[model samples]
Target: MSDLNPRETVQDALYRAARDLEARGVGYAMRDARRLMTHALGIASDRLTLFLREPLPAEAAGVFTAFCERRAAREPVSRIVEGRLFFGRWFKVTPEVLDPRPETEVLIDQALRFQFGSFLDIGTGSGCIAVTLLAERARANAFVTDISERALKIAEENALAHSVSERARFATSDWFSDVVGQFDLIVSNPPYIRPSEMETLEPEVLKGDPHIALTDFVDGLTGYRQIAAHAEKHLVPGGRVLVEIGPDEAQEVVQLFTDAGLTNCTVYQDFDRRDRVVEAFSTKPSKIG
Candidate 1:
């Protein structure tokens, strides 16, 4: 990085960082540069614009330079900053857990539509889903399970940070193997990328995210299969199951839920209008043979 000019303004630094990122083919370069600047300066994103004309502080300039370099290398801004904003709240993010995403908030909206005192979040990476639910619905509690102990720890920390730890229980479980009892609702944003599709993901995802949280290795349906096989048994009568899915997987996932005797299976789309979440109800056992 070029030495920061003592007289350089925040706007000047931002423009330089954005230009560097753009030259490296990063999409939304200015937006990303601005977010990084806010993070580096420890300022609220909304407050950043007000400081744009002020001289860039030496320390913050150094941090911004490092962040821009990481972005140029195809690192996601979330990974660079080690946090993500989801459902209007900030969650700590690391390579250990899947980065919390805006699309997952679609699942959150679908979930809150139903009345549930408790919910079970399977494959609770980063605890965003469970913690957000508890925070949104004051009386709701949750049991969140993850196969990775490290991921569980991250989730636990999020729950604590959100002041929902007392209302949330954590478990290291493969699907429902270690889970006990039923919940008023069940949810998961499981690894759905097929192995064949893994190579096509953005470099930021492939290089910065843990592969275990991105793909099922064999087929993307593995997690859905496990959920279908056991979800009905883990849901209370009239309870609902909501899981985010690859846009193309809606039909197959709905079929799996139907075959499991989970009725009222329906697909909900994200802001992009892509099929993103499959919701089903556990009213009674009546599978189509």
Candidate 2:
């Protein structure tokens, strides 16, 4: 950056980056700037404070500048970097997979509250839910499906990374079309952001994320509709379905579950107290009967 030089101390470098990001309207500018600088420096974030007064090596400074430019250009901090932490673990992220949000962890929490054996994760981007669940349950088996092959690959890598690959199965399926057997637990964080809603989302948040993973291209409910219509066929008797819901979507998603004959539908909120997860149990037997 014209405003920063290699001879600058790490402290000054961070200051300049944070100021630049803040000037560009990043709400968490200081935090992101520090993280980016640390990433570029190849140093632990916790170590930054220890080395604040140290001058940046020319190579490190240039790398930091490039990363700063990417951030300034509206690239998501997660995507610009390597991976994101979810459920206490790091999952590799890419444009092919939707960046895992803290909100989706609500789905994991809700799913874990119930007992299950065979689990199915629809649109299992990054395999965070399935892999994490299998790791937690230890005895559970997972069958994960994603429409995007690239997304499935990343999920598989995540499963392997989490050491749950032995119990996890990956496939390319649209909704439940290719799912054969029933599962005691079915979960999804389906695309619910309506096309109309996209314009309202920050461009940087959407960058490097697949468009199909963001919107149904119809009403945002298309994916939910497919899930509602097909979930009954794949859920075993007494099985549970947990899907992460967008804000203001709990009522509609609950109705869809009820319409599909999944009973005891309930919406659960995240730590932010916003409706984030929807849970429904199968009182009726799997249609596979």
Candidate 3:
């Protein structure tokens, strides 16, 4: 008993999946169906249209059906694909780690503006930030940390996948607890969503992303405070810190940096014009060895 229609063409299957998604209230139903079809066919997205009139392979149809089921259950596309394209590179995604978002690219851009030979990424999650930085700046190295060992494992895997493993070190620690030495830059896209707001998040995010990677269980400022508390001591003279923040968290994060003795605090906006990254510099003089 074949579950897939033997006479169904690829385009027909895609339309059927899209309609199912729409009927289930999935946003961007057609778009997602197209993407999943490409994945199932193992073809480039642009080539999908060429194969539309061809019969859908039984294996591919089964895979597409499973993907649609997951999507209908509110799993993110990234999760369904088990990876995400971040800063033009693919990083693995899983329930144990936070899915990298486009807004975090603002933090990457801000960090790149500084000529840093080394940096530290707190709460590195999947190591998208640290790995991308190391990849972009071939001469740079990084220390990556995460509170969850499982998340750290994924981060290390991403570092390896990007060929940045040699330039990146991993640690399992909350914030800066296990971090060692100072660096020219510090970056993080920490958990900043408030507990109260967690329930209001989209099902794809609320159900797919790790809770520890999304909220602080308190005021959502806990990660920032933890980072601020030890940032100066771990920063080189005039070193910079760049952190991705919630759209409304710019002022509070700036104050945290200011109070921690960092100077030149500046807020950078994302493509959407929402406050997305906060950068600051340590004013301490170079340490004499």
The best candidate by TM-score is 1
- Per-residue lDDT of candidate 2, residues 184-230 (tens digit): 98899888898899988888767768889888988878777887888
Worst 10 residues of 3 by lDDT: 1-10
lDDT of model 3, residue 270 = 95
lDDT agreement with native, every candidate = 0.91, 0.86, 0.89
Greater lDDT among 1 and 2 belongs to: 1
Better of 1 and 3 by lDDT: 1
On lDDT, the leading prediction is: 1
- Stretches of model 2 off by over 4 angstroms after superposition: none
- lDDT, candidate 1, at 6: 67
C-alpha RMSD between model 3 and the true structure: 1.9
lDDT tens readout by residue for model 1, 63-99 = 9888888899899999999999998899999899998
Q: Residues 51-147, candidate 3, lDDT per residue (tens digit)?
A: 9999999899999999999898889999998888899998999889999999888888888776899999999998899999999999998999988
